[model samples]
Target chain A: MIVARIIDSIWATRKAEELNGFKFVLGEELTSEGNGKRRIVAVDIVGAGIGDRVIITTGSSGRKMLGDENIPVDAVVVGIVDDDCNFK
Target chain B: MIVARIIDSIWATRKAEELNGFKFVLGEELTSEGNGKRRIVAVDIVGAGIGDRVIITTGSSGRKMLGDENIPVDAVVVGIVDDDCNFK
Candidate 1:
């Protein structure tokens, strides 16, 4: 899992059929220093909003999180962070 | 999926039991410009060697490639690149 911040929502008119009805969000990875690193698009499973610190699960775990292995998604927002002592 | 070059092999005396007998390699992501970027440690499933440009699969796909869902591995070398017109 990686810590990230939801930066924005994304919409695509044309995409894989398996990806339909899934909410996508742009997330920036957060370092322990609170710096943002690589940006990724992930399925928003936890209803995270922009500015929300989130926990992301990547790869097949995304499918596992949704209980479906055919979603063609590689990343997913699994949790919203309430507080973290490691980073502000 | 991502493109990377295997830079070095790794050995660990202690690791997760599920990871035993797996070959680990340090891989550096390759840009279209052929420059190296982020580095990652991945299980080498394709017998890739140091200096080999390889295709890597992350997350549960690594487990899928190995035909096991409980390997606890995140990244894997899925293929070795032979010729690429995109990068030199």
Candidate 2:
């Protein structure tokens, strides 16, 4: 898993069925040490934007973002941080 | 840390007063064992679709999705999987 922040979101008028009722957000990639990275990506969820702390999933886990075995996905945000996280 | 997939994306013209450009996806939460979980949540990222494997970060990492203290968010997609993940 990775750390990041939802920077923004994009809304598409026409999309696939797999994207029905889904949400997306733009986030900056953060390292495990809790530092920000240079790359930025978009997420498909809701209630996140422009400065909220967040958790991101990468790798195969990211591919799993959708289970239709058809939708082409690479990354995904799984959980939202309710408060400061403790990994100790 | 948790694993999930980006199921879908949603677009809203009249959004929270907080949301501006965030993307959202409905993903089925997955456990560390590589198995899908019962609970399904929305993610915020793009370029991801159903059936695509993905990785997700939880806890404080999520709150950082937006970086904004005003918007309310819990999770955010950070990275897109090019292939599979290997943790050792």
Candidate 3:
């Protein structure tokens, strides 16, 4: 999982069926060696909030978080990182 | 999932318990709009080879590929691309 900071919460009045109860967060990926300019939207199943450093899962495994491979989601927040962990 | 090219295979004689019997491959993520310079390590369950473009799932969702969410892996190869895919 890559380290990322939640930038904001995303709201979609109309979305796919499986995403109904899931919280979505906008985030910018973080890397220890270089700039992490890639922005992505991820489902927050771990209660991550804005400014929280989180571990995100992407792709089919991301879809699998909701128990289905057909879920439209490509990213999901699986863990919130503690300040003490050295990301490097 | 992100599209990436398998750069080479990875070998670890000693590894985490959940990672045993798994094939590890090194890869570079691909993007249609810009340079794909991000390098990553991924588990290959789909038979992707060196130089083959493949789809990868990352993070906790990535760990879920083995049916258990406790796997030590962070990325996984889920698909191989053909020549016809319009990645854009």
> Best lDDT goes to which candidate?
3
Evaluated on CA atoms against the true complex, candidate 2 attains a DockQ of 0.03
Q: Cα lDDT of all candidates, in order?
A: 0.70, 0.52, 0.71
The docking category that best describes candidate 3 is incorrect
- Ranked by TM-score, the better of candidates 1 and 2 is 1
Q: State candidate 3's DockQ.
A: 0.09
Residue range A8-66, candidate 3, lDDT tens digits: 99899898787788888998876434675688898887677799877665665556546
Off by over 4 Å in 3: B1-88
Which 10-residue window in model 1 chain A sums to the lowest lDDT? Answer: A10-19
Instruction: List candidate 1 stretches off by more than 4 Å.
Output: A1-88, B33-36, B84-88
Alpha-carbon RMSD, each predicted model = 9.0, 15.5, 8.8
Tens digit per residue, CA lDDT, model 3, B1-88: 7888887665544333445687777677787755746766678998888889998987666676588764545788989999788767
lDDT by residue (B4-24, candidate 2, tens digit) is 556666667887867677776
**What is candidate 1's local distance difference test score?**
0.70
| Reference-based lDDT, residue B51, model 1 | 91
- In candidate 3, residue B17 scores what lDDT? 42
Clashing pairs in 3: none
